[model samples]
Target: MKTLTSLLLPLFFFAASAASAAPTANSILGASDAIRNPGGAFSVTVTLTEFQAGKQVDASTLTSYSRTQSNGQFASLVQFVLPARDAGKLMLKNGNDMWFYDPLSKASVRLSPQQRLLGQASNGDVATVNLAKDYTAVLSGEEEVQNGERQLRKAHKLALTAANPDVTYASIEMWVDAENNRPIKARFFADSSRLLKTAYYRRYQPQLGAERPTETVIIDGLDPKSVTIMRFSDYAARSIPDTWMQRDFLPRFQPE
Candidate 1:
């Protein structure tokens, strides 16, 4: 017997096709090209531990980041990020699939339709799956937040729904800065009811001629006792090989 989640998979695929049907590249981009031009790979490390509403966590997550230029004449800018937890583990996306390889477990998980599920449902919404058919993003309003003593403007919120029929999401709202075209705060709910996941960004800096997120913290109710803090260090420009992007190459992804 198929589980409830798995049972819903086929239905979601069909629904994804219908919802995404006849949507051309120009239509997908809507009125802006920001999402289509996320730029090239970036080197990053993140530490995440406990972030309860009122609890202290003691763990750190160190990971690496990489992205590719998108397809077409402007496809290269449809960039992505690779955040690996260790020397032997990694998260990467080719064109249609997102691969998460855990060498310790000797298990490689691939999220198909690799463009939709980003920043969407389940696994605390931090698994970084790249399934393209899993989400539809709607730009919300805008707001201002006090970052230190300076007033910073942000995109306010975006309501992301699971594009797959089998998978369901409550709601995931991300606050991105309009001026900088970057994310500042993100929150996820379950069944659109409860606060299940939350992630926010702070401390931005220039690396590789781009303004990027430097400090990120993700805390989920699934394990409320822990908060994860990521510290991105040693930012530099260097090309990471294609073989390193392979699912089986996760165990050999060594940072230099």
Candidate 2:
């Protein structure tokens, strides 16, 4: 009996340690956020490509400048860089407010984060955001989910609901890689509980001192045939001034 007790004692201790070390849902979300976004201010060029039924339709390029606020939120300025016709157009996200500026009209119009920018990509999608700040997360379970490469990966599924009204989506179901805490996939939903889109973060590459997902594939929830690919490149640490994030500065803002 003494020998059996000794053998089981080590097993019990190991089990207890494992349980205590398990990450909470909020911590997992925070880790995933760190993997998705770089710390501090930076700039990256984004190319959005739209596809319908596997056929290419439209494409555009934009440069996004982002700065982290003292409150741990992001303020962004996205400028349209491609297609001469749309050149000089700007979108600014400051706190809960979002605005779109058109140089032609010299007008800045209020916009919603849910507004579609390109294909299935929303105005919120292109901007720098930290999900852990905007939503409250709950761990659902661990499961095997299909990745962007069509391979199965063990992921931690998390259910998230908006902590405030200023978020892009009302609720989201996300899956993060269990091993690395990298974001795998997410399903975005509207306030009416309607499915909006599904996003898969894939194509990890070295960018801005970390291995971040360089490409995000977004699929329309209702129509899987409609897709948009958002590719990130030309990453560099940049100093974004406070004036740049202001809507009034959009007209005078000149790209350097």
Name the top TM-score candidate: 2
Clashes of each: 35, 0
Task: Return the lDDT, model 2, position 217.
Answer: 98
True-vs-predicted CA distance for residue 71, candidate 1, Å = 4.6
lDDT of 1: 0.49
Residue-by-residue lDDT tens digits, candidate 2, 1-256: 5798899999999999999999999999999998888999999999999999999999999999999999898899999999778988999999999999999999999999999998999999999999988999999999999988888999999999999997899999999999999999999999999999999999999888788999999999999999999999999997888999988788899866
Cα lDDT tens digits for candidate 1, 1-256:
8799998999999999897773332233232223312245545444444444555534434444455534421110111233344545555555434666666797777654222222222222333232223456765555675432245664445666666443325455665555544566666666646876566666667755656566666565476544555545566555666665566665666665
Candidates in order, TM-scores: namely: 0.56, 0.93
Native-to-model Cα distance after best TM-score fit, residue 72 in candidate 2, in Å? 1.1
Candidate number with greatest lDDT? 2
Q: What residue pairs clash in candidate 2, if any at all?
A: none
lDDT of 1 at 201: 62
Cα displacement (Å) at residue 132, model 2: 0.3
- Estimate the overall C-alpha local distance difference test score of candidate 2: 0.94
The parts of candidate 2 lying over 4 Å away from their true place are 1-17
